[model samples]
Target: MPQPAGFAFLERDGVVVITHHGRTATTLRGARAADFLEDVEDGDAQEIMARLTGNYRRGNERQARNHPRNKGR
Candidate 1:
């Protein structure tokens, strides 16, 4: 799978942070991903942000803009 365009990270000490252009492909999904990896899904925004510290969201405009023509939105 391709990268999600953006993501977030928590330092060893637990400081939530975000990345506009992510370095890795394929975001780590699920609670662990949201909790530990710091990446939050857009749909899950309210739920995730409420529990977590901040937004580690990525790939919003990029996904909308770069969607594969063959995929058929």
Candidate 2:
């Protein structure tokens, strides 16, 4: 079991970038609040983020699909 490395949280030009190693997470706040990762450069960051978010959303969708909070939808 290895501990994870420290992560860097950066805010630049209204874009917040969270990076650890080569992985990155990004968030934008304003009229449109969007949260995602910065992983479209010349590396495996896109693939890594795709896999990570896929799993994350899958679990969330599963929970939401059965939750009563969204019963009308």
Candidate 3:
């Protein structure tokens, strides 16, 4: 997947930290993540972040904006 600019995440010490545009959007600690993820139908931490911060959309935009069809329009 294409990565959004300035989007970074780190999972350390059983805690998940998400940053978008260089600012923290949310954090998931061990206890909370366990509780939350357990109920999730079929999603892992990385998928959660990708949906939350719209990283995929950004990546698509980044890629599309350079296409010839988008030029000067």
lDDT order, best first, reads: 3, 2, 1
State in Å the error of residue 32, model 3: 5.4
- Give the C-alpha lDDT of model 2: 0.46
- Per-model TM-score versus the true fold: 0.22, 0.29, 0.38
Off by over 4 Å in 1: 1-4, 22-73
User: lDDT of each prediction vs. the true structure?
Assistant: 0.43, 0.46, 0.62
- Candidate 1, backbone clash total: 0
lDDT of candidate 2 over 1-73, digit per residue (tens): 3433334445566665555554554444543222333343344544544333332222378678788988888
The pairs that clash in candidate 2 are none
TM-score of 2: 0.29
Q: Tens digits of per-residue lDDT for model 3 on 19-70?
A: 7766786777878656545534475545556565553333478678899999
**Model 3 Cα displacement at 31 (Å)?**
5.5
Runs off by more than 4 Å, candidate 3: 1-6, 31-47, 53-73
State how far residue 15 of model 3 sits from its true place (Å). Answer: 0.6
